[model samples]
Target chain A: MIRVDHLTKKFGSFTAAGDISLALARGESLALWGSNGAGKTTIIRCVLGLLSFEGTISVGGRDIARDGKRARSLIGYVPQELAFYDDLRVWEAVTLFARLKGVARVDLDATLDHVGIPDQGGKRIRELSGGMKQRLALAIALLGDPPLLVLDEVTASLDVCGRAELVALLGRLSGQGRSLLFASHRADEVTSLAQRVLMLEKGRVNAEVPVNQFVAKLGAGSVLHLHMPAPSRALAMELLRGHGFAPTLNGVGILVPVPATQKAVPLRLLAEARLSVDDFELLSPRDASLGQENHA
Target chain B: MSATALETREAVEAHAPGMISNVLTLAWRELRDALRARSFLLYSLAFLALGLGVSYVSAASTGSLGLSGFGRTTAGLINIVLLVVPLMALSTGAGAIAGDRERGMLLFLLAQPVSRLEVVLGKYLGLAGALVACITLGLGACSLVLALQGGATEPRTMLWLAGLSILLALSMLSVGVLVSALARRASVAVGTGVFLWLALVFVSDLGIMAGTLAMRLPVKSLFLATLCNPLQAFKMWALHSIDASIDVLGPAGLYAMDTYHDALPWMFGASLIGWIVVPLLLAVVVFSKRSPV
Candidate 1:
């Protein structure tokens, strides 16, 4: 549904994204996986034709540079920032977007229902929770029933449940034969929704992996910190070690470095060992580095 | 790319709205927002009070509340329009793009299929509509009072002032949009708007007067300088409509009358229209040239 060729975006002396190329086939879903400042959003912006970049991008066979308005007509974009006029009621906002998108007819209730925000038409935009706001952004993106959806870290601001719900909704949408090009750093979202994953680092595409093998290749990039009784901590470490896991102890907890996808495995092992975990925290690669800094 | 993945150009174009539709939709939103804002209510009330207050005060000398003709009421309201209208226009227009950028709303709007020119034109029309509403509310109430009190004489003068005031508001609004498009933040746009207001209303006049007195400048130079400021251009026209001699404008007015002769009104009228059109076109160009980032 989209193809990017040798795309490079630079801001003055700094390159935000460099020589990244990828494609998404019709009805297929892909994720740009990277940490913050890793060029995922930059690549997304370039694809959306929001930035001037070297090389070329074509959406639905139209060159974005030469035909941005029509090329964008095929896309429904949900930017990372869920910004809207605060004083406008939900129905008014949706109607306005519908007109902008050239949706000839608007069934406000149906669109809201699809995004799980039915009956929110009377509420002001300012009164919505983070989850509802994200849902509204999605609803706005879905206007005109565009074939492709370009989402930029849409669930970053949502809580755990909100993220899960949105991801499931996206999965359903993808299942219904809509192409999705989304940028996300969450392993679960990628595994659940994307058919392919493009790993990004330092403004370049590091690797492209099939979703099935993505987690195994990502390695032990995340860590789980289990805060247990001091006596049980040693046993937890040993038990985790026997399970082919390497564990270390920090000041307040036992830390086991694991692939993000295997976060639950360590907990499952502790439960099998009957070692109670008082509390636990899962640190992604970025937070893991911060954890190391604190330990140092 | 697979054939199924690519949509035909015609198919894509079918989903996109016409430019006029986009502009009108955006304009409607801006107008609605202005109407709902607290500032709009405050502005309307202020104009209403100014209208009533000016008419009553002007007629007080005649021992009645509405005995003063439209000529006197317009004469009394001209200075307030010169002062308040630009400030109102600036406040309304200065926030157009910059405020949206601050709130990230511009990104959402731009992400749609609409062009940059559509956004600028739409905002200008919507904000201009609001300003017109404010002017009409105040002046309409004043005219009604005059007619009821049997002082509706010189209605043409009142209409002329109303037209000139609206023109001035629109001209200043164009400048404000330019400021909004140039500034990255709302606060900076506001500061620029205020600075422009001071230069047009106070600093420019004082500077020209000072320069003329200190350097023995020609009447033509003084006249040209006055025409360059939209506020001054408005004041001269408003005064001319009330008193054709334009004695209130002093030497520059006399010079304009002597130089332009029969075409003086057309010249100043075109100058005021130029003030409205020139800045708006410049704003559209600058806004269209902005990087999408």
Candidate 2:
């Protein structure tokens, strides 16, 4: 759905992205993974025709630099930061983008339902929670049903539940044969929605790995830190270890790494063992720094 | 092509809206946003108050509640209009792109299948619509006040003032958009706008005098300077149309009247129109270059 070759972007003396090239097939999902300032957003911007670079980018078939308007017509983009007219109601915002994209009014109703914000049609944008606003952005992006979905850290600002729900929605969209090219640092988001992960470091692509190998080789996922009493911590660690988990005892918690989808497995095991925990925090994979290691 | 493939291709082509439709959609949204803004309400009320207050105070000074004509009433209102209207236009137009760019809204808006030229034209048209409405409200209220005071009021002078105010507003708006396009930060854009308002309204003549003294500049150059400032051009046009005399504008006015004679008004009109068109065209060029698309 999208092809990029020799894409190098520079700002004066500094290069933001260097000679990056990648392509995604019609029904494929690809991710650009990196930390802050790793040039993921820069690559996405180049593909979206929002930057002048020394290379070529094409969406579907149109050259982005030569035919940007028509090239962009094939993409539904969701930016990382949410921006809207605060006074506009949900329906009005949808209608505005709909009209701009030549979307019929009948489909707007269906899009709202598709994004799970049908009841929020009348509420002003400022009245919505961050999650609902993100959903509204998604709905706006989904308009015209563009063949390609280009997202830049879309769930970064969303809470846990909101992030999961949006990931699931995107997963469904991918299943329906939509091409997704997203940039994300969060492993759960990357693992949940992307089929192939492109690891980016300081404007260079270090490696491109399939999702499963990405998981096995890097243990790239969120880590659950369960805080409990000192006595309970030791017992919890031992029990978790027996259940195929490598739980370690920290100062006041047992750290367990698990696949993003199975985050509840350790908690379920603890519950079955009648173990009570005081509290827990899940450290997102973005903080893990595993992707920063050079693969040679 | 297969039947289904042909149908899909046709659907894709139809999905891209024309430039006019995109511009209008964007313009309507800008207008709606302006209407709902607190500043718009405040600006309207300020205009109404300025209009009514000026008329009432002018009438009372004449030792009667009733005024004779639009001449004196509008003569009193012109200075305030010159002071307030440009500032209002500057404040509104300076935020057109900088504010959106800061909030990341500009990128999102440009991500759609629309061109940057269309965005600039749409925003300019929408803001022009808003400024026209405000100026009309103020001038209309001032005329109504004169009519209510029970006298033979001349409607033509008020029409001239309305036309002049709209032109002035548009001219200042064009400059503001140009500033917004050039400045990277919103605060910088706003500061530049206010600085422009001050230079045009208060400092243009004083600076001209200072320059003339320091460099011994000729009167012709000074006249050109006065005409260059849109605010000065607007004032000359307003005063000449209302009182039918350019002598009140002092030497520059007298010099222009003597030099240009019957063509002076058209010259002022042309200057105002030039101010309106030049900055806007420059802004379009700058914006198209500045933005990625």
- The TM-scores of chain A alone, one per candidate, are 0.89, 0.82
How would you encode candidate 2's per-residue C-alpha lDDT over B134-200 as one tens digit per residue? 8888888777766666644667777878889999999999999999988887888988999999988
In the range A99-121, model 2's lDDT, one tens digit per residue, is: 88877664656778998888888
Model 1 score (lDDT): 0.83
Residue-level error in angstroms, candidate 2, position B268: 1.4
Give the distance in Å from residue B126's predicted Cα in candidate 1 to where it truly belongs. 0.5
lDDT of 1 by residue, B1-293 (tens): 42334445313333578889999999988998887778778877887888778876665544443324556777788977887889889877898888998888887777777778889999999999989989988887877766666664466777778899999999999989998998888999988998889888899989999999999989999898888788888888777766776666788888888887678678677887888898889888888666544
Q: Which sections of candidate 2 miss by over 4 Å?
A: A220-296, B1-14, B59-68, B291-293
DockQ of all candidates, in order?
Answer: 0.42, 0.33
Task: Tell me the deviation in Å of residue A37 in model 2.
Answer: 2.0
**Model 2: CAPRI class:** acceptable
Best by TM-score: 1
* True lDDT of residue A98, candidate 2: 85
